[model samples]
Target chain A: MSQIVCDSSSIISLSENCLLNLLPRFKVDFVVPRSVEKELVDKPLRVDEFEFKALRLREAINEGIIQVKDVPGVHKRAEQILAEANSLFTPRIKILHEGEAECMAMLELTDVNTLLVDERTTRLIIEDIIALGNFIQSRASFKLRMDREKAMALQERFSDVTVLRSTELIAVAYEKGLLNNLGDGHLLHASLYALKYSGCAITKGEIKEYLQLLK
Target chain B: MKKEFVEKLKKAFLHGDARGLKEISNESAEQAVLSRDKEMVLISLVSYALYKMLTKPHYHYAPGWSDFVKEVVSHLELCIKDPRAIQEALGKRLIEDIAKMDKLHGRFMGDLIERARVKQASRAYAMGLSLDSAAELTGADRFRLYAYIGRTRIHEEIPARSVRDRYERAKEVLG
Candidate 1:
């Protein structure tokens, strides 16, 4: 019964795969900032799979499956950054700038056990903060047990007892037809990236080779 | 590389001349799409111009088209003679333009800056907008924030530096 407070990236990624359906199975009460909700739902939906997720996210909110928590003081900070940012750089970076801050804040406020984010810089900053020995109990990405479970479920032959690598898991996902036309590859890629940062011995070559067969 | 080319770009951008832009666009796209050197320099130049244009409307609008063009042409000419001059000029221009925009926009701008500043100062604040703005303004890599939290668990093992240094003789190790 872990209370999972997800950043926009996790929600967007999960929803895109229509994997928000998986939340109830985990029985994790998920919280997202109102800013994240607005970001996903406020704008007109685009033609991409991302837009599909946005609509689904809105539906999840309506059903009360996912709770929205808006961080106060975020708006004021966003406004300040936007004004200066536009005067300095392109607006394309605007959402990301705020999303990163919001993600960190949400983790702090919820005291959540784990954080789920895909951005490299955000991941790096979290690692830096952790290196400073500030908070005592927080994790990022999938827990080792969770990764093992996912790998097991992904393939019968993956041998759950053996330490199957991310590349092997990806290959299994490919063989099982789970990666076909699915946007979740990005999630897999994010996980792999995080694993690499964590010093996993998994080679990307195997993953790429497996990915070639996915389509 | 040519004085005329620089003059043309200066005139086009200062005037917001769609036609002059059309010409510049065609040439650059050709260079970008076909050039052997990959036209990295030209890409940088175009990026500089676009960055300036999007960020500083007031400055672009201030001198009217012609005077701005003359100023830009002179700047480019200086840059051609000494490349470092362009880097310095670009930095100077950006700071000046940003400062002026900040001054002219006043409270409207003030509010945004304040918002971004608050997010920077407080770990509790979590607005996507504010964080995005702060990162852009501060030029800090935003992703580092996530990694910071993930790595900060107090109970975790001493980091790679100490552990690795004990095993490897030559690796760089932090105390």
Candidate 2:
């Protein structure tokens, strides 16, 4: 069985797209780590606009659709390194978050082989080494700094993991006969784009490709 | 893009009119659907909205609330040409300039950038940009933006039952 742990980004994408209620439809168990729970619930609830989503997330937790787990200790062990890697990216584009780190840790402790993450920084660091280096090189070139060592360190530290965006999940649900209700074959395209605008990081080409593949 | 509106907005900022600032925020929020809050106009609008929330009259000042507001308005004097850049610079300055204070005053100025991001996240999401696209525009992490979007979704009436129905329809069309 395939298992996945979610960072808040994927959760938010699902929520914003009106797809949170459909998590059980997926073949995978959508696990939410503790820190992510706080970001989605505790902190945002303080603001008026975020209150509703937080409450809904709270309800999801109650129903066991979005399972909130206490982060394992390995998450803490990974913290120093994750923080180091996070610092490597400039503040303007830093990708490390406690919730994301916790998801990564869950990967180590469980059979979870993939992490559903939405942020580019962590994804690039783990999955796309060259792009990550180019990002550093481009930024470093601007500052006249050699970023090879730093970039290499970040890559080596987190280079083994696979990252998936919330968009792919939407695609999966679509392929599974779950999203057919969105209205004909058009919903696939519409929902994919919806996730994009609503905050899923998949690109237009990817959406096009997925739609074509499904066809 | 409306010069008159910008001027009125500037005046509202100068006066620390929380209500007026909020009105500006609301008006800008509506623009997301039209794709009108281009190049950070939406971002600036959010900053003002955050300002309104942080400085509400009923909330007693912790200590540096007034100073934070003053400092934010002070930057209005320079470089309004790019409202987004000005807001970003103001946010950076506020974080740098906010003095030590009790939690009551809140780090009104220090959180300018973050609050702006939060607001930007909301605006970008509201504008029909996906989480990825919206996150890209605002430079906010997806999770953080999701939190923002989650809150906004509370009032939104999403047709939750449509995905399966739509998929079935698409299959027939494709077939």
Candidate 3:
């Protein structure tokens, strides 16, 4: 059987769309860390529609169609990782965001092969490779510096320029009657990709297009 | 989008006004039926999550954050119960739909502890999230907070002494 773990974003999105009923269609075991559960339960809703859907999803969970799991050893693994992460280098070449560090811990601890992540910074940090380069003299003395110009350039050129397209996302919304108008569908789709790829240095031009569509 | 709407939602969440919270929650359910737009859906989701975080206090606090977070949460609650009531009636169906979409964000949510905002939010969320309530909201199994922290690696050390010291304090709550 294929198994999957869910993140809060997916959970909220699924819930809001009222498509959570479709979980059985995929027959996947949706697991979430205890922290995520806590995270959503405490968070206040900004949209009336989202809150209502969240409440319903909450009820569905109570009904037991969707099973939420807290993987064991997650905490121990996180602690170990934190310790290792903190001691990674002499002064530490890079600092991991709290979520990134936690995610790295989760990836290490869990045996799952795929993760449905949307954060841009996490993806870059995970994919980018950088190291110290030759020293350069600027007026006084030569100093060794971490040269990530290549990686930075790559990100600037391609990271945000590309987009992840999912026919399922658009199709599903249509099927559920979630797309009320042309503007609604276009803007909503744009926002989904926008927030997901926000860390990629995407151009303002694209964002403006999306915002305009919504208007 | 509207300033008045945002203000109203903000008020409801910060005050833990269950009446307003419930009203908005209903509206979100109704709207999900007609508007299939994912972005609007997400904006709505953020609001709901924020409200839940604020309305309840079930964990430890770092002093100043409680008020600040609560204030933000209140704003979200009003959005859910806007006067329009676009999606309030659908309720459970809406949630089920969202649950299905949640798979898309599973990786992101699973990796939240690695993010700074999520880390801080998780800490704040825990304070307001009872184990039972949290489980109900995110479809998460019952697990001790410490265990989740361990999984996130927040329990681990940092290169900076100051950062490490603060992490230690957050860890104490789990212990």
Candidate 4:
């Protein structure tokens, strides 16, 4: 019953795929942290290609399709979560970034129920700690399960934060008839595959399965 | 020893002239299409493609591409001095490129980079490298590599597994 809170990755995914315009039609207000907005709109502007995408994101904001808000007290919590999350995986190698924590902070301070993210590490961090623990244990390189107390704290602190990729967002929008004009009768398939080729990390077989469900 | 020829080839690539290399390869294609000369020709083509990739002004500073170009240029320098150094040099360059590709390309550049990977992979396959080897070099996702690898000149077979099969494999290992 809460609004959709997204990170830079989801927006970047959609923007890279030329699907940013379709975002407004998702029928829910989209909120990103100020840091995430900086990532979306500023840091990438140095590159010619991303500068164009950043402009589109700026337009989405100016058009009122997206909202950028700074969540209070979220940074502290997010930093804590990031430390715990990184420790769960390979040490000395950071697995999540500040913007992910910002998204979580938004979730914590606001009523957002879902996090729209695209990166695997951040998604794994927020998915299910127990599953992640089992995964690390099964690997020879990672012999220890994540520290129990920290893992439990993370599990409890952000357990309500569900994550969805841009792929699912498009799928849901297609199902909801939000992307009806995207193409012909095969628009759904076309759109799904377009997302894949544009770096959604979705598989063709998975797209087929979802297409079946859409029908 | 073809040192000067290899150096010129390296220059043509680092200088970002695809057409120049293409014309050069076309000339050599017939002369060495089947002889020991083919090895040099294949190496030249690979260098051409890699040059077109790393020298493109658009994504010049990307971490992944930058790392690749750095490794490649060092290898190319070695390769020019000793044309016999192609396999070890370029092979190492390719593996580093794959490992660094998460920094691969910024958003708008995905399409361009993917195109470069496919073109690069085509040359690698024609040179008789395996899919894994090509993937390591091109820095393309294995899934995308598998999808683009059909009809490659390499002709080596890979498992025709579904995405579910990959997922099952993941579960088997992680469980």
The prediction achieving the highest lDDT against the true structure is: 2
**1 or 4, greater by DockQ:** 1
Residue-level lDDT tens digits of model 2 in A1-215: 35567887777777877788777765566777787788778876876656887888888888888888765585775586456554553332334445556676777666666677764545655665456545444422233232557767666755545566676666667777788676665878888777766645555555666777777
Interface RMSD of each: 17.4, 12.6, 21.7, 13.9
Which regions of candidate 4 fall more than 4 Å away from where they truly are?
A90-92, A133-145, B1-175
Question: What digit string (tens of lDDT, one per residue) describes model 3 on residues B60-175?
Answer: 14344554454344433544556343234112333333333333333334321112223322332222222222233333322222224323422121111222222232222112
* Candidate 2 CA-lDDT value: 0.57
Docking class of 4: incorrect
Candidate with better TM-score, 1 vs 3: 1
TM-score of chain A of each: 0.49, 0.86, 0.49, 0.85
Q: Is candidate 1 or candidate 3 better by DockQ?
A: 1
Q: Compose the digit string of candidate 1's lDDT tens values, residues A109-207.
A: 444534444333233233332331121112211111112232223223212111122233333343444555566546556544454333222334533
- DockQ for the candidate 1 complex? 0.09
| Ranking 3 against 4 by TM-score, winner | 4
* Model 1: docking quality category: incorrect
Q: Please tell me which model should have the higher lDDT, number 2 or number 4.
A: 2
**Comparing 1 and 2 by DockQ, which wins?**
1
What is the lDDT for A69 in model 1?
70
Instruction: Report RMSD (Å) for each prediction in the order shown.
Output: 17.7, 11.9, 20.4, 13.7
Enumerate the candidates' DockQ scores in order: 0.09, 0.07, 0.02, 0.04
| Tens-digit per-residue lDDT, B43-62, candidate 2 | 35444544545475533354
lDDT of each prediction vs. the true structure? Answer: 0.40, 0.57, 0.37, 0.57
